[model samples]
Target: MTKVISHVGFSTTARAGDLATLEDSIRRIVDLGADVAELALFGEDLIAGGRIIESRAKRLVEICAKFDIRYSVHGLIVSNFMDAAHLDWQKAVAKAMLELCRRIGADVLVQHSGQMPIGPRPMRERYDALEREALSEIADIAGKAGVRVALENIFAVADTEYRQTPSEVAETVRAVNHPALVGLIDFSHGYIETTRIGADFRAEIRAMAPVAGHLHVHDSFGRPYTMSKFYYTSEAIALGIGDLHMPLGWGDLPFDAIFDEIDPLPGTALIMEIGERFEAERADCLAKARDLAERVNRRFAADAA
Candidate 1:
């Protein structure tokens, strides 16, 4: 069968500013038989004040050269374009991240979908326009660097209104209309958001599949965190609430069904975003992701036939 997914791996859990730990994490991922390693660069201190720290960038490049693994970077989670006050700053950081992608030979840099503080509909519309402009510019930078900017769908919470749904993200990407900009479907986040809004999970995934260039493969019960009181993550796991980021098969996410239906674009990276709590299960999680990718590829081949 033709391959639909080009890479499969887990995100690194190493602490920022620690090259030894980063190397250790990549080495472990390579040992686990993964061909890709996603660098979650948000808190990694690799960039400061919207610029790449030249010394750190050099060291990072050196460290990665020691491994044979491909890379995909998760950009700063707080880089929101919807915030008009800091829009230029956001653009600067995004461009710097694209430069990092080029320096490290990464083809994809993932950014969470834009979110805005809750406000009136007119205000929200303005913010949406700002985001489109920002993403257009960001996409240009990424394209020039030979990288794709993947805008990931995020689940909404009480404090903010995330793009919230796969269709919404798809719409935004289409509006940007840039070849370098594509959708990233984080299935766990999609599950929670779709469940919250009473939408069919599979349908939503299928709708966004065509535009998707990256996938965050993890399991989660279709539950939103709405507890009135504070509790530990263990308690949330017990209740199956929120984005648990559980290892595949540990939660009720229908991976078999979802993969059977959606065919992400060729060369899409199917990354397992399992939390650090499930570290022992990383190998198994990657195995399951490979199996799912096979399923999708088979379907893709059959459709072509």
Candidate 2:
């Protein structure tokens, strides 16, 4: 059975007292028949002034267990805000996340690779060393806690001086070469990251074959590809350029072929890693996920036939 996990990003709410919001979001996801919920740590309660505590972890665990949902961590994108090359904060956050994952019974942690190293070293050399060391350390720590780490490759426009390609995602995963760490592939991010690589999506997935741990599944989005001309951040956030993390099949993410490829991989988790869901779109999104899963199962059934 292919299990579908929903990240709380679906609700766009990530606060501590936002329990009511998360409860409502989980209800909708459960109603859609998903068996897992991804808990993001950056929203509200999980992290405070650059640290984590037991109370926040306990609250999250109780909520997920109440819904009979498996949990994972997703909001630990400390790299985007920090110096990726330095990696002091990245390692710290990863360690905190593994502890949270252990306490929550979530064996998976999904996160983006973040912007590449912005240091004084050679670009590729710096990226290679930083990613290798950081992920290797993360893997060792997570292995101790019996958790898996999945690195997501997101698209972003740089100040021209600070940008890294998605193929580096494949590159770094290969460089690390660990069983505890793997790749988390998203449609939009893969497309943007590999735009310059000339490799197809199937090739991208295959590249991470040895360490392909979990998946952040979604359909293609229609985000703006146009640069904001005035602002780098605006350009990065433009439509379809980055992973806005829309609902499955709602965006143009090309899941049909992608799913077909992964359908053969036994036990690979499919996480519906959408950004934020609004009250207006909640019910419909749930219905769509159910319908999409059924559609996937039927194809598998027919393929088996």
Candidate 3:
């Protein structure tokens, strides 16, 4: 069965200064009927002065044990591997993250692929080479720690085209060809990138499905046009081109189609990456998400029968 996990990242965004509060916030996720928890590790907390916080790593382990919640860690955004200059720092951070995963008993770590420059400079081939190099090192780290590292698809924004679409992520995984490295599908990111890049959403999902070890499931209405905005603006909402992390049905995503593609897989994680806008209604929203996951599983079983 696919494990349904709730994201504690939204809560952490507010309490980034005080990570201890994550313990309290995550306990709420367990209460909401999620089978697992996804802890978002920002670059600020995980990467500093070329090292990881040993004490904070210990605290994270304690938090998971306290709640008895099986967990995974999302990689830090600031430590992206795309930048050539950040490659050394990124490697250090990756090693640190692997150590943390081992200490905390986390089996999977989701990482965002590096950003693509707005204008062509390093060339796509070269950039891809750099990214592959970074992933190779990370895969080795994860392998040694007995954990898997998932490379996520990040959508392109105005200034930079974070060209790591689902297909690209899959191709990267294949190129890296490491057992410990796999693809991660973020629905919202894939949805937006598909529309922008003129790729079929279903095809994108299918291309990545074979290599995907985890998924970031969230509702995205349309392609976001604005820059540096988290919440959907009034204009964007009216135009329906924003990546709003609303509830499932709140958007026009074809969940039935997505689940259809996922059903045949060997049980990938279904993690809800709801935005902070729905923080107040998190419990209720997650309960509905859990129900949706169960419903999908039942349908798959019925189809198999």
Rank candidates, TM-score, best first.
1, 3, 2
lDDT of 2 at 23: 67
| Local accuracy of candidate 2 as per-residue lDDT tens digits, 1-305 | 44332222232246555766776667766665556666656664675544676676677677777777666777565554225545676666667778778887887877677564355657657655666777788889888898888877666554333444445676777778877877766656676555534456567655554355566655555343444444543344344455555556555666556554443233445566554543456556556555545554566667776
lDDT of 3 by residue, 7-117 (tens): 222222326646666766676667766666777766327556558777776776777678766677777765577789768887787788787778878788888877767
Worst 10 residues of 3 by lDDT: 5-14
Off by over 4 Å in 2: 1-12, 15-17, 80-86, 117-121, 159-167, 196-202, 221-225, 228-242, 263-265, 275-305
Q: Give the TM-score of candidate 2.
A: 0.75
Estimate, for each residue in 1-305, the C-alpha lDDT of model 1 and write its tens digit. Answer: 44788788988875756877888878888899997999877756888888789988999899889999899998987878888888888889988889989999989999877787768778877877888899998999899999999999887776456454798788889999999999999999999888877888788888899999999988879788786444687788888888887899989988998888887889989988875668799878888899998898887888899
Clashing pairs in 3: 223-241
List the candidates' TM-scores in order.
Answer: 0.95, 0.75, 0.85
lDDT of 3 at 87: 83
Each prediction's whole-model lDDT (CA) = 0.85, 0.60, 0.71
Cα error, residue 259 of model 2, in Å, equals 2.1
Better of 1 and 3 by TM-score: 1
